[model samples]
Target: MDVLYFAWVRERIGLPKEKVESQAATVNDLVAELSAREDRYAAAFADLSALRVALDQELSDFDASLAGVREVAFFPPMTGG
Candidate 1:
């Protein structure tokens, strides 16, 4: 799976995207795995409530299923100007 980081997430993780071989079946599981990897991922995912996620390019929730998914992106919730 390709995990993507946006804005401050990219800053925290030090990358915009990366390919991951994960056994995680859900978004939360993936997050847990990523967060456990290092401090960078932990910080990036610190406040899950403040984030918005996209699965396979479709906006979704943190608890969404990852079945047959090829991409997962994390970013802060967008605000209208």
Candidate 2:
């Protein structure tokens, strides 16, 4: 899967995107795996409420299944002026 990070998430993880190999069944599971990898990943995924997720370019919940998903994007909730 191609994992993408945006805004502060990109800053924390130090990458815009990366291909990930995992056995995670859900978005939350993927997050736990990444968080266990390093401090940067932990910091970026520390508070799930502060962030939003997209699966294959569509908004999704953290508990959403990752089956057949080719892309996952993480970013903070957007605000418009």
- Name the candidate that leads on lDDT: 2
> What clash count does candidate 2 reach?
0
lDDT string, candidate 1, 40-75, tens digits: 999989999988999988899888889999999999
For candidate 2, the lDDT comes to 0.97
Q: CA lDDT, every prediction? A: 0.92, 0.97
lDDT of 2 by residue, 1-81 (tens): 999999999999999999999999999999999999999999999999999999999999999999999999999998869
Superposed on all Cα atoms, the candidates' RMSDs to the truth, in angstroms, are: 1.0, 0.9
Compute the lDDT of residue 11 as modeled in candidate 2.
95
Best by TM-score: 2
Name the TM-score of candidate 1.
Answer: 0.94
TM-score, every prediction: 0.94, 0.96
